[model samples]
Target: MSRRRRAEKRQTAPDPVYQSCLLAKFVNKIMYDGKKSVAQRIVYDALEKFAKRVKAEDPLAAFEQALENAKPALEVKSRRIGGATYQVPIEIPANRRISMAMGWIIQHSRAKAGRAMDERLAAELSDCFNNQGTTIKKKDDTHRMAEANKAFAHYKW
Candidate 1:
């Protein structure tokens, strides 16, 4: 940890189409090795495909819904005591919650057996929006773990 005061949080600009800062941040996280354009293309393409398949509203809405469904409320953290490691259930921060949701969704999508990125991402997003995908399953597992270890809640500072 730094002894000096932490730097201020920088403001982020929204995405070009939806004008959502959250989406922009998600895109930044999705980017690999500074390939931001590729990330943007993949997300936009996935949204476009979803919009065509769903055919009623905007793709951004679906994306937002997916994010909402994927976000986890609580997670268990490992804390060390004198000899044993305890599972401490902690409430996830808002920003981290969103990041984790996105990461899990993207990871599951990448691991799926799909022919194209758009198809895989769209499938994952749809599953997430419907609360029936790997991401949501992962969230459920986390919550279950946290619930199972609720006795360690007092260990949190």
Candidate 2:
């Protein structure tokens, strides 16, 4: 880690269609090998599919809700103090919470077999919106672990 002053966060432009920086960040996370256009197409197609599934509901709103549902309130961090390492329960930072939710969503979607990327993403988003999906499970697990390790929370810096 650098000892210098923390660097300022770079600003990200919102997605053209949705006008949402959050959605743009999600698209950037989905991009691989610098293929941003391909990533954008996949995300847009998935959002369209999701919109079709829920009549009269905006896909962007659904996506935001899904991300909120999947966000972990607490997480355990390994901290070394003196001679022993302890799992310290800590509240997640806001930006990190969003990033982690998006990561889990994409990760679980990629784990599905025999499906196109767009379809898999759509399914994952829908499931997340309903609060019943792999991402939600992962979030629950994190909270559980943090709860179990609450005794060590004082070890947090």
Candidate 3:
């Protein structure tokens, strides 16, 4: 952690369709090479496709569901003391937990077998919303690992 005083929090505007700042942040995180337009188009396209699959609600609900399923409640961190390394399991922060979930979902989506970015994103989003996907699996794996290392929870700060 930095020794300096904590910086002021900056506000982010919500996306036009969902009116959610979290969605805006996720779009920004998904952007590659600083191409906001491409990221926006891809996310919007995926949302449109996802919205069609589930009736009565907007795509943002699907996005939120995916995020909820993908977030990891706990994670392990490496720490060194007296020339020994320890894998300490700890609860994740709220903001960072969400960011990690979104990043992993986007990354795994890109790694999937799909013809287009939008298609991959849509598929991943659908799976996550349904509680089954690479991202959700990853979160489960993390939880399992944390559970296995429950004895090390005392090492957390």
Q: Top model by TM-score, which number?
A: 2
What's each prediction's TM-score? 0.91, 0.95, 0.91
Candidate 3: tens digits of C-alpha lDDT, residues 1-157: 8889988988878987778999999889889999988999999998888777655277887788878889999999888867888889988999889989899989998998737999889888888888887888999999998899888788887
Q: Per-residue lDDT for 73-118 in model 2, tens only?
A: 9999899999999999999999999999999999999999999999
Every candidate's lDDT = 0.87, 0.93, 0.87
**Candidates by TM-score, descending order:** 2, 1, 3
Backbone clashes, each candidate: 0, 0, 0
Per-residue lDDT, model 1, residue 142, is 96
